[model samples]
Target: MLSAIREIGRLVVEQVINPAQSSGGKIITIVLDEANAALQEVGIEDFDPEKANRYLHTDRGSKGNAPAPFAPLTEAKKTLNKIRTWLSGCEKVIPKTAADCDLVNTINRALGLDDPILKAVDAAAGLLQKKDRKFLTVKLEGGKTFLGDYEVFRKAVAYFADRKAEKSCSTGCACSICGKIQEKVSARTLVYGFDTDDKPGFIAGGFDKTQNWRNIPVCSECRTFLTQGRKFIDSRLNFKFYGLNHCLIPQLLVGNADVLEDIINILSDSHKSVSLRHRIKRRLTDDENEILEFLSGSKDNMTLNFLFLQKSKSAERITLLIEDVFPSRIRAIFEARDHVDSVFSETYNFGKIRTFFSKSDPEKRSNDLNKYFLEIVDAVFRGKWIDFSFLTRFHMDVIRRGLVKDEYFAFRVGSVNLTV
Candidate 1:
């Protein structure tokens, strides 16, 4: 499992970062001019500016209008301190441009002041509140804001990874995932969001002493890989279905990155086009077909996996379902769907299919529907007959209770005809 997570991370990094580097662009650079301009706009004076790397970090408002500081202020300070440390350590590589010097001076000045950092934090917070902005990200050189760019953040993480590797291991034991004997296994935390209440769930180990990180014994390298991989997945491969809080993460092996991206794009676009009527549309659009065909054509040795996750009551993310299927299986599933569509295309115009799969409240219906839906898709892909008993019973109950009005009744009737 640790190997799989690490492999996923590697794939993500390759797909995301390699192309940027190949294009002759630096992964991240200090935008001295922009940072100086922003600081000047905020009315700071006479401080020699420091060149700072453009990186993503979060800041939030102080609590109410009270004079006392809040958690967001503390978080902002920590983030600034981290950036300052990183910058100070990399003085050799930092450009000696005028803007860079000014940025460094400004940072030093701010740090020296007892209340300037607080003032800046409050000013940014005020902008967020007055402008109704979602983020309080700092502006940097080149008019670009630090919007939490993963590539930039990865460098910081790499620095920490080196430090972590240097730590002495408490117990030298064989890693559970890699089978290598190593000292000092660490827990891997997968962070999905920024809320303080959002629990950082462990991928390899948990809070329980019996199931501690040491017990799982993942080496620091693997642990770092897992962290980076989760960050990439959360940023790029994750999508929400409708308004539900659940996320669908697609993992692909043996397929083109462009094709996988297209598939995810279709899913995201379809999600945005969902009707206001709360009806779930299962049919693929014309645009979706082109990409699917491209995906299907490259299925010689391709494998695809999906994870359906939702937040638990404790605000921790948990996988609700998982599906691992080959490209051939996906093609088979598409064929089966077409067959079903043909059977009902004339009488009900395939309306019954939607009715059979309708999910009004995703939170309540997702697990059962996702499980059974995948089961049916698998059965069809495997060239086996699908069981319609569950659908039949559900239709009968809806009719018996007259739970659906005329339009829905028509759909139920049309769906029943397809079952026969």
Candidate 2:
């Protein structure tokens, strides 16, 4: 077994990583880490199945060596994978606290806030309230997005109130969400963040950037609010909020792939980077377009709205991700990944929401949520999924009831092509 473990690392190094002629630079790094870590954990102070198992002493006796080299590979591979999962988090490449702090200092200095910004943040006790954040917005403008740590948001109304923007308050202070303009705290105290994709206002389902603030961009107003709001907690972290820029177009496009070159180009904008994936696969294919032209016998008029998943619903998509990194095993990786609350993926977390009984409000501090709804009409049409082939009436009705009113599941009646 010990020798088998050794062989596992060797094979992985030789077959999976080293032998791959087209391996990317990023993949090579992961492979190296896995191999080194796996080899270190597997010790050779035990039986040498490759040499002579008889030379080794077990509880039973000196068992003869296994003849075949690859015989133990199956078990070896499985054990190696388990060991790798355990060790991956032990040596994370990314540091704790999510983003870099020095950048914030530089930005604050550049903003010409002087030290008063720091004093104001300390007055507001920013550090004390830093962890009190609820919802965050992953907003981007064209190719530029604002990914930063903001204690609070300065609503458009507030900016107008400060007369900072020098523009009329389209929405006045009285009608505003409380008189929070002076304090710079948004009435919508976000406990989490809005997983805004590329489009600024509209958030998609499934694909949300849950990366550190260094990965998400933030607008100037947000940073100012954070820089000032820290006074709510402590003055020290007034300049703590800083903006970051990231390009995740490659991973997104690969996972949510389509045949259209134009679409891909639009997504991977060399001119403008757009970081957002779709909820379903609705790319127009040549065959489908041909079918449409043939069926309608018209080419002049073709309208496709291209349905995008709602931000709330999209908060639940987790199917597509990059292949290179051990994204799941990274320390606090789950936090960076938009959370899932659907029954199907809820188990991915700590089984927190998997209760036998339903709750009136079972939401949590996470990005994705599966707001299940009851669908009596659809239940009647499709019946239910029972035996491999047949659908019994009793079983069908039982399944139908489950779909309806079950917050764990969501969907009415439509073909959803999700890339899992």
Candidate 3:
């Protein structure tokens, strides 16, 4: 798993650093929606100098409620202090371009401000009575202003990235994935599919004083690569099937862009064509064949993996249902689905089969629905026959639901007759 993640990270960095791509660093900044609202309250069409300065510098109290004059000022001071640290450190790492110089000057200017920016921050803190403090974002206008525009911010982020990569890892153990002896296997470098949650401990290991990132046994370079790869997959190669199942197709390519495009098209077609709304079920089999043909073109050389994830109720972590399935195996699994569809099609339409198997009632659906799907998927991939009892149960459910229409009922009866 560590190796796979590292490979993905390498791919991401390759794509990102590609001269054609426009990928860059990201920074967090506060959005002052309440301050804007406060300005608009006084029929100020355009922000006055004092209001604009205040809006740019400070945020509403952390809770969004109007607090004492010092509350927002304190927050503003914290943000400025962090920016100052970044500015000071960034000078050593980043080349001093004109924009970089301007950004540095802006930060220095804000730091030195006593009356307008700072004083307005205090006044804005006192005036804001609403509890609608906006989120910290890189997407807002004022935030962009604080960062001296997106291009400069991107440079700054790139500088930070370089600095982070150059830092030494603390752990000297050989990387489990690369088998390289190196220092600096920090957990801060590694990226997980989901955010680390300490409450239920979804991150899989303790991040305490005694046991740190050393437990993972991944080096800093590998960790950075994997993190980038995860981000790229999350942004680009991820998709949904049945709107309920989240799937990620991470491809290991040897510069075969055509094959990659074909795989993406195949997956997209499968997603669109196999839905319950689609009546011509046989088309799905054809689509599966198209995918199979694409996979076979590689002759088992290309590696394609799938990850199916489910979000936890608290939305803190994703529970993986299926991880790292090969494209060839996925093709076989779909072939099994095609076979199952054929068997049911003789009696009922494909839609009915889907309806029967798929969880329709969110309230009453078994928690084991994903487990059942995983079982079927595994069975299909392995070319093992689905248990006869499973079909028997489906037949029983159909009878109990009074869904046994004429031809369908006859087919069910014939199936039972053959089994008996």
Candidate 4:
């Protein structure tokens, strides 16, 4: 059946799809040839970036297994070939007739805004285009939480935030193009529930950089502090707020919008501007439609998606179930590990914690009436704990019977670990 589907797909591509001229193969070939030809085009002995890193007449240290110098000529030829091939193909696909001008202008005309305002708009747009970039981590913000895209962030704030005459530029992620040369850091930032907390404590951990800090981790106190504002900015410009999945927001530091706008306006002269209507629309609401439209226009520089999962609650239930039996016998023990760690920590700091067994009275006192049921209760709980295997099986049995009453309700436990 899979073979039949592939056969049909191939047939459609071969028949219905006209094979337009493509220099894809040539592009790959040129890329492959770039290393050999670099010297002729670039005027360097080789593209040894390390050697290039040195200033004029600077001393350099020699490392073992020095790589061969790169030839820059190959790279230049490769770029020229790529552009030529691309433009050739583009001309075929794009209409050359003046008859198409009105159709193009229809998209160009933003009802009331003039070319000057449009240029400013275009400049603002250019700021979001992330350039010379690697990884970026943005803390989740309430205003931008719904945005879920860096591309949108670049465009929305890159241009003038205030149209009122006295309004000024803010952060500087700008354009070199004069057309809006928008750029945004493409790195994903998140408030992970506890992606990696090196220190194990009451709540979860701080963001795990290795894991890209993706979830919301909150303590009991921090969770309670969320009611004060929709979004709050601290002196550090770090935004803290609630995000999706009822999680606390991560802190994202923004770039300089003022410089970013200046550069974008300069670099983005050739590019068209996003409309004032669009700008006003973006600034006015936090609705999904407007947010999506803003992101949709961004040229795929950054994309973000949020997934919802009930991790803490799930982990809690799993932990409780595993701790049901005394010293738990889940075979794949986890909470037992945490329990062992806890006990070790307690014993290690024994000198620091001598309170549990330290009652004010030198000798302990118990009522004679309590002595009767105490032993019986101990016996009942102890009978299940005498053997690990028997205890595990017994724990599972009691849980099954108790769960029949209600999924979350558990009646008995040898270790008194029952939630209900």
Candidate 5:
């Protein structure tokens, strides 16, 4: 799964860094110049995803003041403080003689507690909340935006990547990821929310914290790819299954990136349609828009990896991992599901099975039975065998509970049992 994430990173590295390639829409830019110390609201301009790169985003940290050059106007006061911090941080990184310093100075002079730019943001707060209007950049008249400077953008990228605990850079060391001996390898290559490597106990051989990089050494280039890949997975590939979260990662069987690209497009939001049964019955124009059908369409070129994640206030937990699921297996599951639906004369779905293990309030946290439910789901997807007795106990519990109240429980139980 980690290897597949690195591959995805390689695919999206360019798009993640280059604003023009990754994003579209207009930005409500604030222009500052010699004549305009209070700032001027220049009309919206095209969004450049590459321009934001590492400069504008706050992905590494959760705190409000986590050092970012630009911020979206989501919250007025918070955005102002972040912009102030970003300018201060930029001043420390950029040399006095650098061209970026002059642009930064122009922004510093114009911004204040009672600036016109704030008023502009307040007026456009509704528009600013929109997806395309998420980014707000400070630019000088006839000069580039603060994030548009390649030098400062590079610095921001390095800043976030090096925010790791390890500082001892290695030279001519073998990268644990790609297995290549590189001149420079970074210890901070791992993505956030995947694992907890803070404690020395988690380190290999329980060595010093600084030597943690030796456990999973990765080259700088590969690090960038992984970061971008993680972003892609978070934004596009991630989905909610029942009450749990899962990332649908496409892995190529033959090392063809095009196949990955095709899967991505097929699963994209623009290509998505109604539910599978509805689309099939209605005869939708784009039959391949449904996820199950498209996934089943690919027989040999690729497979899928489902990473089920549960997030809390502190960290994310991996509850289940169903890997290397072939298209044939997906087709088989759907075929069985269709047959069961036909026999029952009522629409049957995964939710019905999930309900047996659910609490009265499904939104509540999972209890002991939740693990069993996930295990059953995994077994169904992987075609793994489950002990008959082990399954019967849960079925018996459901039937016992239904006897108390649910009048139509017999039909519900029968449908789920046959479908499973």
Candidate 6:
């Protein structure tokens, strides 16, 4: 999944999708048009309402309660403080090269203001308060976000990419992703719900928190791609799966990135996905629309990866991973399901299978039995063997529970038939 994500990130960085546009969310952007002009003065009169644009800025990182590196705005004052701090850092780090001079001067002028860009931020916040908006961002009128700036991104990468040097380590360490020893590596796991930074015990080597970089060491390039890959996943591939959340990732088979790019485009567009499903006569359960429908008519050059995950706050727990499922296998799964439905002369699908495993509680939420049900799902998709006696045991349990008036007898019988 991490490798696939890195590939997606590579594609994103290669301009398959503009990283700036793709990383953005539903943000109320306060465009500081004429920054040079704004820096010349310090008053509300200098702020322009025309510069404000409300569009979707899908920064998934900020959607959670955790503080992101360049977090979106919750309060105007805090946003200004971040801006000030960022500018100060940029001034100190951005080289005086001809290529960087313009951005450096902009940062310098923005910070040089006696009142600075406070008025613009205050006015922008005031405008946001009048309407309902989930996030706020300040950008220059040239259409580049602060985080989207090339220099800012480069600085960020350098700061993180050279962590080995920062820690005063002269020797190279092995990177978990590429399996190579490198002088520079990062401790940050771009994918959340995987390895968390807060847990020291989760570290691979020792309990020394400062030396945690050795655990799942990722190189700078891989780390960058992971970041972009996560953005793509969060914004596009994440979907609902039988009352759970899953990420549908595509892995290339023929060494052709174009095929993977096509898959990405298809999944990202609803109309294309529906059209593909219809062309292939694919049937889907209600929850399966986002999961199986899009791959119905895809080529055999790539396989699909389904990662069912549970995320709470900052930690994520993977529920199940059904990997390397080829398009041919998907077709086989559906064909088998259809054949069963036809033989029974009744509706049969995964949804019905799920009911047999569903909790009898009032809310019918997930419980310990979910793992067993997921195992069944994994087995079905992978064409793995299931013990006949185990199925009989479960079926008998359902029947006996119904007979004892624990559940409706007819419903249990129907459920048993659907699975059998």
lDDT tens per residue, model 3, 1-420:
446556656754564321111122112233322222111111102222232223322221222332211122235555444544555655665566886665555544444543444344444455544443322221123332334344554555544543432333355667666888876454434355343334335333353423334445556567657656555455444644433444355455466645554444444443543542243333322122223334433434346555666655433244444444466675664565556546655432223334445553435745335555456545544556888788567556645554534334655454443332
Q: What would the TM-scores of all predictions be?
A: 0.55, 0.15, 0.53, 0.14, 0.80, 0.75
Model 4 worst lDDT run, 10 consecutive residues: 55-64
| Model 5 per-residue lDDT at 331 | 82
Question: In model 5, which residue pairs have backbone atoms overlapping below 3 Å?
Answer: 17-50, 18-50, 19-48, 19-49, 19-50
Q: Identify the runs in model 4 with alpha carbons over 4 angstroms from their true place.
A: 1-74, 98-337, 344-420
Stretches of candidate 6 off by over 4 Å are 17-71, 88-134, 139-174, 179-183, 197-201, 209-211, 277-280, 291-301, 363-368, 392-409
State the RMSD for candidate 4. 28.3
Point out the higher-scoring one by TM-score: 4 or 6: 6
Give a tens-digit lDDT track for model 4, residues 1-420: 111112222322333322111111110111111122111111111112122212110011111121111111122333333223322333343345553333223212321223343243233334433331111111122112111132322222212111211121122232211213233211111112322324323222244233221122222112112211111111111211111121111111244433323322322222222342245232112222122223324332222221222345213111101111221221113343345446544211111111111222324462222222222223332333333453345345445655775655322442223210
Best prediction by lDDT = 5
**lDDT score of model 6?**
0.62
| Superposed model 2: Cα runs more than 4 Å off | 1-395, 398-420
lDDT by residue (72-157, candidate 5, tens digit) is 55665567667667667677766667567765665666776445667676676555445565555566553444454556656754
- Summarize candidate 6's per-residue lDDT along 97-125 as a digit string, tens digits: 77466655664465455353556556555
lDDT of 3: 0.44
C-alpha lDDT of candidate 4 relative to the true structure: 0.24
Best by TM-score: 5
lDDT of each: 0.42, 0.23, 0.44, 0.24, 0.64, 0.62
Error of 3 at 12 (Å): 2.7
What's the true lDDT of residue 56 in model 3?
Answer: 28
Stronger candidate by TM-score (1 vs 4): 1
Candidate ranking (lDDT, best to worst):
5, 6, 3, 1, 4, 2
Comparing 2 and 5 on TM-score, the stronger one: 5
Q: Which ten residues in a row have the lowest lDDT in candidate 2?
A: 23-32
lDDT of 2 by residue, 1-420 (tens): 111112222322333211111111100001111111111111112222222211111111111222211111222333223223322322232133333233222222222422432233233333233333211111112212222112211121133223322221222222121222332222211111233234533422233322212122333344333322221112110111011111121121133222222332332232322122222122112121111111122121221111112224224332222222221223222332224324234223111211211232336343222221112111211333323222233223333565776733333111111101
